[model samples]
Target: MLPLKGLSVFDFSTLLPGPLASLILAEAGADVVKIERPSSGDEMRTYHPRVGENSANFVMLNRGKRSLCADLKQPEVVERVRALLERADVLIEQFRPGVMDRLGLGFEAIHAINPRLVYCSISGWGQTGPKASVAGHDLNYLAETGILGLSAGADGAPVLPPVLAADIAGGAFPAVMNIMFALRERDRTGKGTRLDISMADNLFTFHYWSIGSGTSGGGWPKPGAELVTGGSPRYHVYKTADSRYLAAAPVEERFWQRFCQIIGLPQELRDPEVDKKAAIAEVQRRIAERTAAYWCDVFAGQDVCCSIVTTLEEAMDDPHVIARGLFDHRVKSGSVALPALPVPVAPVFRSVAEVRAAPGLGDSNQELLGTI
Candidate 1:
């Protein structure tokens, strides 16, 4: 048993953000029951290219959790959820602004049934913003909040992040932290608190460094021109001789100097007379002169903060990751690879007694209704 083994959570959310939040709780040993729709269920279940019945996205994000599919529109279903909430210590939801309210499962409504429930609402723009009612994805939220604008490519279109910055960082992480703190606070006051984790708000906060840099007179990412935003030679991805990529970030002066020395670049490489483009071009040229593997070998045990760009396949088989057993395979609905939770303690068991593989449209009717 882990720290949260007995703490029950009612997770009424789906897709990337809310499910991930609840999954974290589940991983830590909370008895989290994911409340999916009676119809369609969680969209992420079939979002990706499926290997048999499971989607890699769903299985990875959702391990060690039970699914309680409910037609939340039904009065009996809503009351059933209320019953769970009455006993649960936490409730997490990620519906757009008014969906919960329409379902008569708003925080105010449910909190009346169980004032001790730590309620958390995860949304794109939060529950009360001007854009609160508007629909948005991770990219749109970050774009509106200025994070997507910064550190974007020098090309025309902005690049979407590989990971869900807003989802994991903004939604899941904060929900876990806040729920934990609230649970702790309830130890003293014996009452729970509500949380509004807006994806847009979190994105804005994620851009704090750039925001501070600009508004505070440090200068923001001037489009491929800022610290870690491609202005400095120390930070950026370069195309190597074999057409593979190498990412280098020697941020500090010493590290930058060391990187230059390793690559045989002169101090004159920083001269403005050569122009930023020409200087970067020279660096690119030098990097391209050698294969990525060659540079990878050269930068070993160096303070250069340099790394060969590992494709997803390469990352899974990386020596360091393999040494730590990070991506050990497990048979879920089928054989699957999952990243182990990066924590101090090790896991005893990796499976859960879960039924209804990601809920195939109203799969939990009998279970949920029987509970009622």
Candidate 2:
């Protein structure tokens, strides 16, 4: 009895944001029917370095989801989806704004069929904004929200982050939260709702530190000038002498004091404005003198919130992440390890395995056609 177990989601999203959102739902027990194209499939199949038929990007997202291939432009296929929409609790679409309306499968069309259906539109800029139709990715969204400018590095330019922050925050996080809220609302009103979440617009929340830098619009320099964006030594990455990086965060006075004490720095270096840079530089120099393994031992069992800059392989064994069970590997066969999810049963379906792999273009035609 996992949460969202019985609920069926018609997922028309591809690439990242929408699919990931639906994946979370699927992980939570939503019967997610990934409605991909009959030919090329979701653009994600062709994305990244391939890994044994599964795209690294696709597998990371599409686990526990069912595949249903149908071309919306074709009347027969559209009819099939329309039939499915009648029984669907949610419709997750990541296409541009007008594409749905063009397909005659917009919110109005679906609401007419199932008034209780939660319709979610995930996009880079949002559905109604002036920039909604613009083609953009995580970088574009981050740049638009002024968050990117804050992450300046030693080169004095914006640093490229490793995650799809905008897509995750604005698109996925909001999408799931919004749909959940709508589910609650549906329970009360017995009707559906429309959700429009924009990745570019939501970047403001991710840049809280940047936004907190200054109140006056003219006081800020887009993003790179902000407190959280490596502007202060308190929240920056430092390279050790051995080329290992130590990610430090001593934003508070108490933590800074402890950090200074651990590294044996002068008291005057405590003030963020007057001595922050020097303090960080000193820590960098001191930490550099030792290897990451040595500092890991040094910082172990400490509350300084200081950590080594670990790579993907190193991150898997990170203590906190391990404790939380961040990566759930259930089924393992020789060379393949598929992610297993045992989502708790609530009001939703818990065991949703409708679409397994990216299908062979209309692979489920017989199964879906039988339903119609």
Per-residue error for 206 in candidate 2, Å, reads 1.8
By TM-score, how accurate is candidate 1? 0.89
Candidate 1 per-residue lDDT, tens place, 1-372, comes to 577888889888888778777776776678778787654667787777774466767766666667777778788768777776777899999988888889988888888888888999998888896888998887787777777766467574567778778877877777778888999999899888889988777766766677787798876566577756787676778999899989998877778778888888767885544466666887898999999989999999997899998888888788888896655534254444444333222455333333213333444456655765
* Candidate 2 C-alpha lDDT tens digits along 282-328: 76777778887887888787788898888887777778768865454
Give each model a TM-score: 0.89, 0.89
- Cα lDDT of all candidates, in order? 0.75, 0.76
TM-score of 2: 0.89
Native RMSD of candidate 1 (Å): 3.2
Q: For residue 102, give model 1's deviation from the true position in Å.
A: 2.2
Every model: Cα RMSD to truth: 3.2, 3.3
**Candidate 2 overall lDDT versus native:** 0.76
Model 1 clash pairs are none
Model 2: residue 210 alpha-carbon error in angstroms: 3.3
Which portions of model 1 miss their true places by more than 4 Å? 270-275, 329-331, 334-372
